[model samples]
Target: MLGAELREARRRAGMKVGALLEVLGFSARWLSKLESGHRQTDARNVARLLGAYHVDSETFKRVMDLCRDVDGGYLIQGHGVGGADEVSAVRRHEAAARQLFSYEAVGVPALVQSEDYMRELFGRSVHLSADEVERCVAARKARQKVLNVGVPVKRTFVVRELTLRHLSGDREVAWGQLMHLFWLGNTRKVDVRVVGQDASFGYWDLYSFTLMRSPQFRPVVHIGATPYSLLFDEPRDTGFYEESARLLLANAMGVEESRAFIAHLAEHVGESVSA
Candidate 1:
């Protein structure tokens, strides 16, 4: 996490790694190792780099905090989250994640949600002001950049059948969402599944969670929380979400079956939409 942050900060500052090596009197391999997470970095090194980068206070604090994390904690606890602020943190991980797994029991995952469906979903939330809702939707759209075909991120999305069946209790909206999900399932590097009666998911109540893994940073588990969500980078916390993700996969319909099922559901419900 520290290494990744350093690289991001350097790029933001438009500083070439070669230039930094000469100024910092560090070898190329050593700087590469530090920025690649191959070797843990110290505060002194980080301070010097940030000083050269001329980073702002927030980036300075964030980077220095990551430096102090001898235990290598990258947890972002957003107790007082603004609409876009917390999502930006998660989006940073999503932007760099090599792989992503999202399980949504209540509604569609943000990464794959259609624009209309997302706006409608957010419209129902009383807690979010209009501007806040707009910012949240915009942030999700930004994060969805990872879904671009050229991006290397592989994504898996598992959603509940019931949630698809009656989303916002609007057949047209639900049909569009189902069609979108089915289309994404057939796309490259994307897998969409539906949790149906194929297995015992009756007791499942978890709303939404996503796990992101990157070779350059520790894995993170994001759980839904008030105002926003909390990110856990510890092995113990990530391990539990990993297990839950496995269970979700075990309970969800096969990719082909889910695709076919969603297609059928969309055709059945899209009559009015098409009409």
Candidate 2:
């Protein structure tokens, strides 16, 4: 998380990594490893870098706090519960992002999931009580607020067609979520597409990931793991996810076709429930 902030500070300072290295008199390889979280920098080095970048005191404190939280580790992992440091880190990135790209294979993307769908999702957690489920749902809704802020988040989503077919046991919930996706797709803020089962990238069904981009920071990718979500800011990791998104988009249905497809599915689900 500190590395992500450092990269953001460098970008905000209008200094490329190479240029920053020249200014700091550090080797490119050293800076590279530091920024990618492969090598930990001492507090003195961090102070020097912050001074070089002219970062504000408040931001400096926040970055330092994050550094301590991670124990100099690069990855932040936490359960989906609210108020955890990992959750806070993810929220910070989400709030900062100007653009969000997401791919989901088995479930709906959180940004557009309906309240009913979300509630059902959280309710399924064996360990969560009714109140805990509500809290988690509330936290998720708060995350979606980024989409509606003054300058709304620009979003692109690629979902597997199978995701449309698999209902979370409630036809109304499934219909509501699909209609929500369809509605959002028609809006200017989001572009939603679906990849058919026969698409070239069928293997993408194995995982779900999100990439968030902001003018102030380097792109960050979040991969959902079993017990925790893994956050990656390293160029190699982010690049791999970016390329994966590109490949998925290449084979996904076009915006209009995807909207039509979602509408068709929602209608089918509605009819099924009526029948």
Candidate 3:
């Protein structure tokens, strides 16, 4: 508990190995092992490390509690095809999550990509080089494998009408993606919703967003815009985000109605309909 906090605090304070060792009265290698979690720490050593890092008693106790809780909170982060750093962080979180929720407006959640759809979309994008686009699409498809048949994770997706109309590549690709959503709606593992544009709710207009729910780390919020991807953890700020999410679900079309909407869209795009 103390060791992890101590290591991060030392790094933040810009303390070198020799300086940290001299200040803590421990050998450099010993401190390194402790910091790395290779050695079990006792209460006395925990107190010493806390003192070395100048961590207040209340904060130190909070850190200790966090270390002890195996199932703490969710780890949320920003992610997408255009947001690589955000994508990588989300990939890690998705692998660890037991349940996932997303709210989207513009682009599709890369977490549910089909290889064909990705290729088609990327093929049409001028912003990305062929190689870069291929890698991005492939990574997204790989991430989607977690939602494949027999996978235990539960996924819920909420999308608005504007996002549904925003096509990538061509009408064919857009229709295929819509069909895929319909199929997923029928599946037992997914809960799909479509929020109508006219369905008024007391929530801010967001570009797109994702929320990962787990019984383990603090909830993570990730947002992206062009070249910037931001991660947020302040609960007060996220309070509205959560509230908006609930309102979206409240105002969104139910599973059956959403499936019907997808079916209607597929027919509009001239696709052979199963949904």
Q: Which portions of model 1 miss their true places by more than 4 Å?
A: 11-45, 56-58, 61-74, 77-86, 202-207, 272-275
Q: What tens digits encode model 1's per-residue C-alpha lDDT throughout 1-275?
A: 56777888899899987888889898888877777656776789889999999999998998787677435554444433244234545667777888899887777888889878988877778887898778767766766777884768778999888887877747777887888888888766789988885468643436578899988667777776665556667676687778888888888888899889899989888887777
Q: What is the Å distance of residue 127 in model 3 from its true position?
A: 3.7
* Model 3: pairs clashing at backbone N, Cα or C within 3 Å: 72-216, 73-216, 73-217, 74-217, 76-220, 78-222
Q: How well is each residue in 15-87 modelled by candidate 3, as lDDT tens digits?
A: 6778767777888777866654445556567666666777767867855653443122222333455454335
Reference-based lDDT, each prediction? 0.77, 0.78, 0.65
Best prediction by lDDT:
2
Report the CA-based lDDT of candidate 1 relative to the real structure.
0.77
- Candidate 2 vs candidate 3: which has greater lDDT? 2
Clashing pairs in 2: none
RMSD of each: 3.6, 5.2, 10.5
* Pairs with steric clashes in candidate 1: none
What value does the lDDT take at residue 131 in candidate 3? Answer: 83
